[model samples]
Target: MIAFLKGRLVEKTPTDIIIECNGVGYQVHISLHSYSLIKDSESILVYTYLQIKEDAHTLYGFVEKLERELFKLLISVSGIGGNTARNMLSYVTPKDLMQAIASNDIKTIQSIKGIGLKTAQRVVIDLQEKVQKMYGLEDLSTSVYNTNAEEALSALEVLGFVRKATEKVVKKIVDQQPDATVEQIIKLALKSL
Candidate 1:
């Protein structure tokens, strides 16, 4: 079990990275969240999960241990695989994913590119209890109204902006100002986009 890797970063992209440990170079698949965290570093320590298959062995890396743990939990579901789990992490932060699973937010899970309604439901049903147990549902009650964010995202999409890119920008804006209005978010997102 290659638990983690600490070495000089040889190469990096949105989906993967190459790290030189000793004299060996390891290609590690990573999600966007991890990439954003470790992209600027020349040297990094990434927590990894090794997936073994009949044809290949792959290493998935995470910037945080909790994200790696969430990836493991995601892949443990019946219809989820390594790529799908990685996509889920790429689409949303680990904390948001945990919250979605705990709150049974099938819509959010289904919004990820490769996931469908049934798979999203399965993910929620299979992991809801575990997620609630692992990360107690304490903050579930304080739901922030994200209608402004949703409206801003919709407006951006209607104006021909890609949802994926617009989402990142809108999320950043919302994170920085949780109580921002729809127009404020859209204006801010427009500037960033």
Candidate 2:
């Protein structure tokens, strides 16, 4: 349960990095995306997940919580090992992965080196609702829509509608109109609520 390592990076590679925290060097496995982001920095705070097995203990690190969350979700799917999950994170961005799973684009997920057709399909089926719940995605095409949608959701929550139900309605409205303003979204959400 090593939540994170915040220290100087002593060694780095595409696959892993050694971070020195409080005079101790800890080797942590990482995805390519994390490597690229931390390669140029002197110090880093790597979010970590420690996996314990009968034979060995391993630590996987990510530069962002989004990446780490995706890693955990990927590993939770049937037939996806830690290595396979890491490989998937290395091969695809978290945003793209969520989009692919939500849109049921099995081909995009299967494009990863080790992910096969069945695993990809299973990932979509198992994670699609989880992803949607975690992200409350409507139209991921722009950050603006997401922000407005979230603001409207908060407003709806303040208005006493259950957060989950309001989120569902607001996300549906957002999906139908990506350019909806916060007020417009709240108004439309009120009607739906």
Candidate 3:
């Protein structure tokens, strides 16, 4: 199996990249998270997972081993194919995904495009125990959001506020007052909206 590739990045896009190694260019699929991490680098080493089928051989590349590992675990769930797993990764960072699963936050999972309530529930039910065991409670502390900001964001989203807009306003408020509580953030965001 081709475990990894090290070469010049000949082409790059949000969904894929072409890595040229030893005069051969390999097309590698990637999630948005990987793209963001690797976009500025001219040369990179990407750990890969090769999926072989009768008709095609596909390679999915990751900037971090942890992301590849998460991808593997995501695809292992019933009804989640590689593309669907990639979509999920594109929607959220691996740390956030781990937190969502560990906390049984189905709303976060369901928010991703193409994911329904059943799939989100299945993802939590199937992977929550395993993710908590592997990553543990300590690892979740350093996630994408402060607990207050995250809770406020969730509440704002439920109230029909768009996430991008809500985030911008909430971030401004939090930046001005770093220690803002969830209620404070939500109250300020509501006014801004």
Better of 1 and 3 by lDDT: 1
**Residue pairs with backbone overlap in model 2:** none
lDDT of each: 0.88, 0.87, 0.87
Q: Write the per-residue lDDT of candidate 2 for residues 1-193, one digit (tens) a residue.
A: 9999999988899999999999999999999888888855778899999999999999999999999998899899988888999999889988889988876778889999988899999999899888877887543434766699889988888878899788768767876898999999999988877
- Stretches of candidate 2 off by over 4 Å are 138-193
Error of 2 at 18 (Å): 0.2
Tens-digit lDDT string for candidate 1 (1-193): 9999999999999999999999899999999999989966778899999999999999999999999999999999997999999999999999999988986778889999989999999998899888888876632322232577778888999999999898778766776787888899989888898
Clash pairs (backbone) in predicted model 3 = none
1-193 in candidate 3: lDDT tens per residue? 8889999999999999999999999999999999999966788899999988788999999999889988989998999988999999999999889878986778899999999999999998889878878876432233334677789999999999889888778767775776778898899889989
Best first by TM-score, ranked: 1, 2, 3
Each prediction's TM-score against the native? 0.72, 0.72, 0.71
Most lDDT-accurate candidate = 1
Cα miss at 10, model 1 (Å)? Answer: 0.4
